[model samples]
Target: MTDLERDHSEPPDCLSIVSQVTNSTRAGKRERLAGAAVRVLHEQGVEKTTLADIARAADVPVGNVYYYFKTKDQLIEAAIEAHGHHLQTMLDELGRLAEPQDRLKALLRGWIGERDLTAQYGCPTGTLASELDKRDDGLDRAIAKVMGRLLAWVEEQFAAMGRTDAKELAVALFASYQGVALLTNTFRDPDLMATEGARLERWIDSLT
Candidate 1:
C-alpha cells in the first residue's frame, strides 16, 4: 500500500483517528472542528446540531469528524474549550488597559461589538450553556468553568476598583448582560444590547 494508504489502515486511536496522524495535521483538523463546533452550536444550538452539520461547517468530511471526536458531546466540549480560550484571550487583551474600570467598560463594549450576532443567536456561551443544562450529560460543568473564569476576572476587576462586594457585583453585572442577551435574541433587536450595553458602561462608571 502507498504511505498515504498505509496511514489510513491503522486502527483508530483514543482521539478516534483511524489513520497515522501527524501532530500538526491532527491539531489543524481538531482546531477546525472546534472552531466549527463553536459557530454551528451557537447558530443551531446543541440539541439541534449534528456531527454532519459541524463537519459541513468545518468543511471537513463527515467521516473525519469521528476521527477527531467520537461523539457529538465530545465536539461540544471542544467548542466550550474554544470559547474559554477566546474568553481568556479577550480578558488578557483588556488587561492592557490602565484602569480596572476601563477594562470593565471595554468588556462591555466588546459584547456590544457582537450586538448583531447576539441579537441573531443570543450570547454564544449563554445559549449553549442553557441548552446543555437541560441534559444530565455533564457538559454543563465544562461551560460553567468558562463562565467561572469570566466571573472571577470580573470580580478581580471590581476588587481592584476597591469594591467590598466584588463577587456580588460581578454576578449582577453578568446577570444583566445575560438577561439582555436573551431579550435581544427573543426580540431580534440589536438595539437591546446597544442600549443595555451603554447603560452597563454607565453603571460600571457609577460603581467606581
Candidate 2:
C-alpha cells in the first residue's frame, strides 16, 4: 500500500481484539490485555517485553492470551493500533478549541497529565515509534503513521497562522517535544516536561 493508503487504512485488529473490548458478553479481558500491552510496551522496549509480562500486568492467565493473540507480534500490532485510537481521541478533543492557537495550546496541554509518569516513561505516542526504530526491523511504520498525522495536524495549525514554512515549523515543533521528553526521561525531572510545555505555549504566542 502507498504511504497515504497506509495512513488512511485501519490497521489489522488482530482478530477483532479491540472490538472485543466492548462486548459485554465477555469479561473485557481482551480490553485489559490490550491496555496492559500498551503500558508494557511503553514502559519497556518492545524487544524486551514478553507476553508473560503483559499477561501478568493484565492479571490474565498467561495461557488465556493465546485465545486472543496467537503470538506476541499480533499483540504488539494490536497495541499499536490501540494507540491510534487513543491519538484520535486526543485530536478530537483538541478540535473542540476555537482558535488555531488555542487548539495548538490545547494539544500541549493534553500532554500535561501525570508529570512524574511522563518523566519516567517518556511520551507514549512518540516514544513507541522511537523504541521500535531501534530494532530496524521495519515494524516502526505502524506507529509512524500516528506521528505523521500528528505532525500534519500541527502543520495545519501553523499554515492557518500564515506561516509559509508550516511543514518545517511542524517538524521543529515536534522535535522540541521529543527533545524535551528525552531530557525528562533521562533526568527523571518532571519539571522539564512542564517547563518545555510552557515554553512551547509562549513560542506559539510569539508567532506572527
List pairs with backbone clashes in candidate 2.
Answer: none
Model 1 residue 60 lDDT score: 87
Regions more than 4 Å wrong, model 1: 1-27
Mark the 10 consecutive residues where model 1 has the least summed lDDT: 5-14
C-alpha lDDT values of all predictions: 0.87, 0.81
* Candidate 1 residue-pair clash tally: 0
Q: Model 2: per-residue lDDT, tens digit, 119-162? A: 88888877788877876555688889888888999999899888
Q: Which digits, one per residue and each the tens of the lDDT, describe model 1 over residues 69-143?
A: 767888888899998999899999999999999999999999999999998999998998898899999899999
TM-score of 1: 0.87
Worst 10 residues of 2 by lDDT: 4-13
